[model samples]
Target: MNCEFVIKEEGHLTQSENGPEVMYKEIKTEGDDDIKSETFPAGDPLAFEDTKLEMDQREEQEDGIYIPIQCSQTGENDFTCESLNDVSNKSFTRKPSDYTHSNEKPYKCSVCNKSFTQKGSLKMHLYLHSNERPFRCPFCIKSFIQKSHLNEHLRLHNNERPFKCSFCNKSYTTKSYFNIHFRLHSNEKPYKCFVCSKSFTQKSHLNEHLRLHNNERPFRCSVCSKSFTQKSHLNEHLRLHSNEKPFKCSACNKSFTTKSYLNIHFRLHSKDKPYKCSISSKSFTKKSHLNLHLRSHNNEKPFKCSVCN
Candidate 1:
């Protein structure tokens, strides 16, 4: 949210930013009323440690409430939306950080007793307790708690990928997914691991990498009892027991358990040899095959028979 527009009801205004955190301003309207306007960095899908800010733990200066409102559409991509004052007849008295500051959680969940700063935010959080999915997809039997989620689900059914990468031959249904993918081309690693000081483009990738350092394998196979750091890896491991090859090739009737294998299978049909031997000018479909071919050039017999060795 880029809040640069002037408010109709004016007073004095103050603003500041902490690191790569949100850029926000405090508008002190008449009668000492506080109206907050916040703008986070555009195309940044992270909401972890970098965004964490401990609010000033001071006395309540004003006796007013706050309601978050934007000039237009609000979603995962907040940087795109321009924040205007009094849009949808809404007023702000406190920033989101103030909830942690004053310990003032006005909205409380009836089911779980969980507290929240905003009413709308609390209403969305209640969906978890009630198991209520209001947003339903007409094409499929899937339902979602938020409308934005349902919109993204609908795109899958429609085969619509609106966000196309200018740098690569890739597209994404959601802006957040696109932003994460775009980071790979830009070589921007925002999420850093505190333990190893290693970084990753997305926060989820950093979380997965942290599991390696912690020796945490949460996703366990029911059949084999083998554990994996990621659910996708567990799903792929399960295919060995089930022999379920879901990903199918369009050109041929060949199927694979994983999408990566299916993508490699497509190269066979297209004759797309991305992996090449620099010495011989020979190409191969897989990097493993090219590595094996490279071994022949150096006469490196790494794989020795047990009896012979």
Candidate 2:
């Protein structure tokens, strides 16, 4: 008795016919939805044959029997057709067979709705959905859906640098990560700033640069509500909010927001105060102090005394 099961993992449907030896014919079902009627008898179940299987295409159907004009990996099977029509439409023709690999997809994924040309690919995808990593790397406990994926994962643990960068001696685990990092070495600035005419190698860098041009301070310090363009800048600003100044001045007991600010503050201790009052001979440790002194010498009140006025 002939039994029909969902074709998974491409293999032969071997059976001994009761009558004359049945010859197997390959069917093309690329576009057709209803697949099952088309069948051909052959000698062995594993013997690959050459059949003219033209996927879903405009063809003449003689007495409802679609002739195998071309060989393909698919076919449309109709269960409603009569036995006589079925025999007529399902008859195989004789011709020289040229065995070639087919790119036809038989199974589809139910989780991600991704279709694959082979059952093995669909099976691998199913593993990702189920989180079932059968293959594990020996060096690292990292698991993979397939043995090939596990082999690739093992390279990182083994320190096997398979993919090398063209610009630097640095290597990576995968070609995709290497390709992304390669842009850092290239002079190409594809990501352009929308506010200013500046460009950068990465989009995120360009976005941060754009905030400087637009004065876009999104990340605000919770203590002072003083905003910054970048998250790191806000984090630095938060230290002042908490009164937790980690950047201490070695010269003096004063604390600063950053190391750079501390370095600038350290100069206050030295007698080398380069910022002298432009108007008067009075000198100061910081430029801001000298600037205020210069305004006093000029007798110019930029910040108006509204009450006196």
Candidate 3:
């Protein structure tokens, strides 16, 4: 078997040339006549001796350059370009001189196939696949992949609302809430009347006002087709149709459609006037009750119809 040795400069490993600066030290070996001795220019003499030993070992084993080996046992050996193919075929070495890219990236991630250049990059990329943020903030306990990300998170502790609105001068920490607030300024005519020249901010409010104009009722109970504009109004109107008054006065046991009406009816039982008339000493729980009481004192009614005599 014939063996040949080739060496290039430190930085010029990738560069292919005829041969490196050769050494004249020739050894005529005992067993192999076809064996060729080659040398690399070395700054250190001991390193050159070790390289010669490794080349001799490879020649004796008759192994290809691409065959992977644990370089820790091999000591500081010059890495040959022929030995490395892609990144998958190599094993790592614990020795200080085994810091080669070809050996480091053994396992590639299936998601991106991104070679880590080191095992640690592959480990960190696994967190991205798992959605795991192991490193957490000490103050808030919010986790992050990197320490720099955790440092950026600490600034949120001071209640510093840096993202300011261009129009209103109102500030928000998050941009999402600020965008929702900005929507209120826009004249969005989402609710438009079908029969009249009118619009409203909300659909429900528009439908409520539309009932007074059109006298049309759309929403109705499933049990009964008797319709109404509002759901709450339909709910109350259904009580009139069924005569089912769930809201009852605790004082009188007289039920009503509304809790407010039942509260007013309870005051009727005790004769307790909580709401006093602004103009008079007469007090009543209901505004209508007080207004009715005030009517007895003053003969002039301002809300009287103009058509009435």
Candidate 4:
């Protein structure tokens, strides 16, 4: 029977005086789910081919190769793929055969009800559902689901900003952030709100804008019944219930619940009145104070005078 052998160790093959040493460990038979892995050293003659092979033939796996296994399983073979025919380039193609394009997605995720053709794809999808972040940033308390995401996050700690925009000449640590900023210059708003028909550069911004029309506040405070459009806003609201102020001012030693509040408080110490009223041309330290001052010019009294009424 034709047995499908799993490619181990970057799917790399090493050439020796004996033969092309393809170190394969676990080989699954065609008929069953149970994998029967048997080790056999390089010897006299054991030819392996995929198509046009006899019942007692063995060959490389079709679709399941290069699915990403632990490095320990790779053995002592130099990396390679692109079918058994061409192995001279040392480049690997994870999906090269027509068999991989099957519409049948047997594996399904329980959390989000998402389905995938491969079991490995479903396993990777399941990572987003749980808080199982294997990769951690050394600079911050943040963690990532993949090591590649953590590698991109590490650029924030370093001085170098690799991804630069050609249009605006602005630099970003990550490519994803750089791409979103570049869209602003090009006016390429791919994410459009269906309700308002408003265009946004980013999908996250569009989702936030949709909240105004739909009133879809997914993040709700457990203590209070109040809901917020974003999770970060909900987190800030939680501090009010707990009476916790994490951000403290260095000059006056006054504490605030959020960093944005702490930054506004800094303006009071520096005497930097940035918020200027348009009507009166009067400057205020805080934007909220400037907004309150604007109400007097417009004769907008939200608070009622109980004694006069």
Model 2 worst lDDT run, 10 consecutive residues: 54-63
Measured against the true structure, the TM-scores of the candidates, in listed sequence, are: 0.57, 0.32, 0.28, 0.50
What is the lDDT for 259 in model 4?
95
Q: What is the lDDT of residue 288 in candidate 2?
A: 80
Candidate 2 lDDT for residue 270: 69
Writing each residue's lDDT as its tens digit, candidate 1 over 1-309 gives: 343322222232212121212223233344545444334343222221111121121111222222233433232212212233222222334343432334566778998898865555666788888899888889879998777688788899888999999988699999989999998888999999999899999889999999999999999999989999999999999998999999999998899999999999999899999898999999999999999999999999998889969
lDDT per residue for candidate 3 within 88-191, as digits (tens), equals 22332222123232445454798889774433446667778889886687787689865545545665786767668888799876665566556567765567
List per-candidate RMSD values in Å: 13.0, 17.7, 24.3, 11.9
lDDT of 2 by residue, 66-85 (tens): 22321122232212122123
Candidate lDDT (C-alpha), each: 0.64, 0.55, 0.54, 0.61
Better of 2 and 4 by TM-score: 4
User: Residue-wise lDDT of candidate 4 within 1-309, one digit each (tens)?
Assistant: 222333433323222222332333223456445444333444211222222121112112332343323233333234333234434324232322222333666667998778865444565567788868767788899988666677777887786698889876889988889989988778899998887789999999898988888878999888878998999999999999999999999998999999999999899899889889887789999888998998999899899989995
Look at candidate 2 and tell me the lDDT of residue 140.
62
Best by lDDT: 1
Model 1: worst 10 consecutive residues (lDDT sum): 51-60
Question: What shift in Å separates residue 264 of candidate 3 from its native position after superposition?
Answer: 1.6
